[model samples]
Target chain A: MKVYAIYILNKAGGLIYQNDINPGLNKLSANDYLVLAGTIHGVHAIASKLKPTEFEPSSKPFGGEKEIPIESSATFSSSISVRDSTINNDVVNGRWNNPNTNNTGLRSIETDLFNVYVFQSLTGIKFILITSPNPIVHNVASLNLKINKGELNRQFDLAKEIFHNIYVTYSDYVMKDPFYSLEMPIKNNLFDSKIRELAK
Target chain B: MIYSFSIFDRHCNCIYNRRYIHDGPLLTQSKPSSVNLKNSIGDPLGVSITSLPPDNGSGDNFSPLGITTKSKESGSSSAINGPIPGYINKYNDSNASKLLFGIMYSLKNITAKLGDLASLFNTLKSFSTENFRVHFMESATGLKFVLATDNEVDNLQHILKELYTNYYLNHVVYNALSPVEFGTDANEHGKISNSDFINATDSFLTSLSVFK
Candidate 1:
């Protein structure tokens, strides 16, 4: 439940900010952090590509599908239908309930030592949090233990909430600054203090 | 549900592998209708779907014979080996196994180095991807047992221990014919091909509540 580090990757997959909030994990060199960020970015992209296609329902319908669209309206209905169709498709595809539509890519990587949660914003920026294992999983060094799914899910929700707060602070302290340039290293003291507060 | 189980020797060679294939749809929280489809089809073993026992629940309910009493309908293992389509049946000596071993080896070292510098036994227990979760356990002798299951399933440390003490020790280690260390030489890359060991493992795993 403890966050070890935080890495912010820009839209272009470059490391813009890195911070270590905890001391459990060994420290990495500055160059190593950049390499790690790039490796994670690459792995995330590759993992999304490795997503199984066979399980997904076909995007296009067969036979009468094209004919029904032609017979619908042909004028203003086309624009409305386009929007309606996507919603309908999302419902049919069972993606309407998904909380993270923008984050259809890699969500998390969990190891015995820690868990890495990737929160990709709609704008394509990524917030990666490396944290210790869930409390239930913390006693893995011992042989006998029970894993409660309810607790794990609650931790995951808490992580999302943390990201939401970080996103808000970023928008305020980093994005609102007139001197701040886009896609550059975040060096603002206010943002850093806010992040520290949130991490605590 | 458990998708596959693999064993890696001290030398990072995959000595044994088993992959299970099922026709049921992937068990993701997003799809409720597909779960209904799976229910209607019933389990291949035809065991009645029983609710999972709570933490510290009664142990007597589980039969001693291990005939899969609990149902894992809530969780599902996606397509076995998601990225690879044609490499289902190939086991042990495959590129996939080698790559898996390599990942585990490097990650184990990283975890060990990152943890307390004074302690030497800070090995990695498990890791998970978007699709499946791998549960790992290492023996004092350095034998690694890796079990890949659905994401919903949690800590299988006890299961791995059971496999090591009950099955592996009896079938492989105690048996005189099997080699002590696997893949020690160029020609004798020992694979755990013992029929007795395989049958025992199959029954043991099939009897688990998680196996579907």
Candidate 2:
């Protein structure tokens, strides 16, 4: 769970802030980093688009049809009505649950080398956390060596807490600063020190 | 339940890709020559049928027969080249690999921003979700290996290193048909088409307990 780097991208996909907490990466030009941020933002959009769409049946009422036996028609109409209502209810519930579908464009991408966690604010600002691979400590270990599920949850909980604190610090030191401009590079000393503290 | 294994050169060009299917018998889309090689190395008779074992279930001894049987069944031979049903192309579509490369590229640079004695920058190693785990390893020359497994896997760095040393370096880098390219996706000519590499990698991946 080592966080190697962190990046912040504006809603427009511009690189607003970048920090490297650990060493071991090669250097890239300033322009290249912006390009990388934009590319990730674009890919995240595409990934959101690529998410599988849930199937939903149309809820339109059945049109007029030839009369059949009362019993058969009653059963057929009742089944259709039931299906329609269920579909309608699902649509209603889905919309209520996820009003902003694109609020978080790219959630995470897991690779053999590292895990990237993306935290997108309600305002569309994105925070990307690049962390070392999560340990599979018990993959081949003895049964006694397995870490409890609660411990794993606690590790992730810590990560979430760190990200939240970073967001809070950003809002205070970077966002509210009178001199700071939107989508500009963050160079505030307070923000930097606070980030360093969080990383530590 | 391992999904696939892919090897990328420093430029993020996918050099070798093998998708593993578990819903049915382990089937792959590898060519015929690779299949023959696997048959020779894995299971000559194809009599072994491997079952899905419990994840992290310890105390059960890892049987040599079980390992060989799995290798034979999952071998990417020429005969079983059928349309894979659960097969997933997670990266190629939507240029996800390009984005992946860009993220790592910038990360390395930022990490190196501060002066360090080692002259090294740490990059992302691996990430997992509830469903799958991806293990990543990079060689000294920038070649990166990615393995996406559905179950937990251990010692993946060693596996990646072995694959790089035993297969990629020997077969692709040293092969006459392929020439290494920089900063560009490895086109078909640059891809690892060697049958021996594919066979060796298939056997190695299948031997992992996570490949069930």
Which candidate achieves the best lDDT against the true structure? 1
What's candidate 1's DockQ score? 0.12
Question: By summed lDDT, which 10 consecutive residues of candidate 2 chain B come out lowest?
Answer: B58-67
Candidate 1, B113-202: lDDT as tens digits: 455345646356665544555677788878899887656676677788889998999999999988888877645446787778777888
State which candidate has the highest DockQ.
1
Runs off by more than 4 Å, candidate 2: A1-7, A15-116, A129-155, A166-200, B9-13, B24-117, B121-124, B127-134, B140-142, B150-155, B169-191
The B-chain TM-score of model 1 reads: 0.66
lDDT of 1 at B38: 36
**Candidate 1, which segments miss by more than 4 Å at Cα?**
A10-14, A38-113, A122-124, A140-151, A175-183, B23-89, B93-95, B120-123, B140-142, B184-190
TM-score of chain A of 1: 0.72
lDDT of 2: 0.51
Could you give candidate 1's fraction of true interface contacts? 0.15
